[model samples]
Target: MEPLGRGDPRARRPRGAHGFVRSRDGLYRPEELYDATPYSTSSDARAYQWSSEDRSPDALLTRALHDESIDQALGRWCDPRKLVGVMGGHAAERGSQEYADATRLGRTLGATHTVATGGGPGAMEAANLGASLAEADDAAVDEALGVLAEVPSFRPSVDAWVDAAWRARALCPTPSPNLGVPTWFYGHEPPNVFATSIAKYFRNAQREAILLMICDAGIVFLPGAGGTVQEIFQDACENYYATGDKVAPMVLVGRRYWTETLPAWQLLTALARGRAMEDHVHLVDTVDEAAALLNRPPVSRPSAPDAR
Candidate 1:
């Protein structure tokens, strides 16, 4: 099927001012939009607390506003050609080797491309934290990781998780602009705040599709489970049919992870051969390899709304 938002005029606008204030100094507080609780405790994210009534009317309206506003802000600021996406598990905790590697990738990618993620904790937050710490030294990463190690996972407590992330940002204060597209449909997973701009929505399907559409440069897959596997084929199918004038790279990081552990690399490769997506597929061991392959030439726009 054709990707959603094809020939969308609103998707074509280039970067411009969004509806709210953004700071290049440090990670801004929870996005102050339809909901003021992005900075509040994680428990505040649930729809149940949205209004004096049930989480119905008010919550629904807020979601509509967020969807529209997020679409606008993304079009105004995103350059799909320079956008790189990293998909991975939401379980990778701070101080782990996996988290460290993902962070390193984010820092390096931040030097050129604007990093984007699913906007949750685990590997996603680690990548965002990496880009945020690029200007600092490794010691900064360690110190910040120490802070995040407090909760380790957002599953335990979203509030604690975000508190740790905010503390991490304060300790480092590295100014790297990143984008996060999260959905409230997965209410359990609070949106990660590593990105300077967050386009949070209520529709999971729209969020998933937009996330893939905006990744014109390419997407890197780290170790993950069912959801990540679904994404691999979703992107592959799009490439097989050749979306737009481009078939963005789909590089899998961690040879062992993608090959033996998750075993999606072989399937991805087999699907690519003799297909339009053949050249765009790659497999490597390190984050640097993933970034290098993904940053190569011919990264083109998708069939989605073209940004100005």
Candidate 2:
């Protein structure tokens, strides 16, 4: 379970090579997380295990450096403000109606904007899958869904799950580019393969904030559990005090789910009262409605200073 570092005898690249520092690193492709094949145990899995077992200085340093690299890589990806984020529970099974809705939501949003997700299985994977095939026809999307339905969960075998997704991807005419931000903090849930570029981190807090911050285009939250609830408010908190043109639309799909089942909307609306975000928050029943709200004419704002 040893990580490749300064003391590793098999090392070829120096410490300044990609992934060791901010300057040298680049965004990760799904294949970069694997040792050899997509079916094999990922470097992320191995690193998580090593992190849990080792509390040494070097181990801590490795994690820190990796996170820094991810931050740098993210800068090269795209304008964060243009990214539309999809958040939901990881428990939604492949064949379930909820999974289908998330996928459709991603597809709709991906048609106009770059889609970003938490990069785990279930609804997150579903959304990323849809975004990747945004340019393809509806039949292709349905076929991919059918292929994924074979393996509902990744619990018993991640290999089988990944194999199915790879097969599904082969059906796409032109896979669109998308972003995935997964953290090793929740190591049990592996990152999905659908996202073209990944910025994986070791810190969950950093990952969460960055995900919310980058989605200035807005976030569409689907039915989810504790993590999803936290994200709703976290984004709300940012919007609450934000000035003109800083408020990003917050669309929560599943009216009953947000109003009755989880009841986050009640408090969310209360929080947005008398604020600039009041007009920006919405609760809708369908993914199409959510997409419509997000796809509305962009909010007029002052020009930001050039980056670079």
lDDT of 2 by residue, 126-223 (tens): 99998998898999999999999999999788888888877888898468998899888898888898988888888899999998988878999999
236-302: candidate 1 lDDT, tens digit per residue: 8778777546788888877887888889888888776666567778888888898777666664443
Off by over 4 Å in 2: 1-24, 37-40, 298-308
lDDT of 1: 0.69
lDDT of each: 0.69, 0.83
Q: Against the hidden reference, what TM-scores do the models get?
A: 0.78, 0.89
Clashing pairs in 2: none
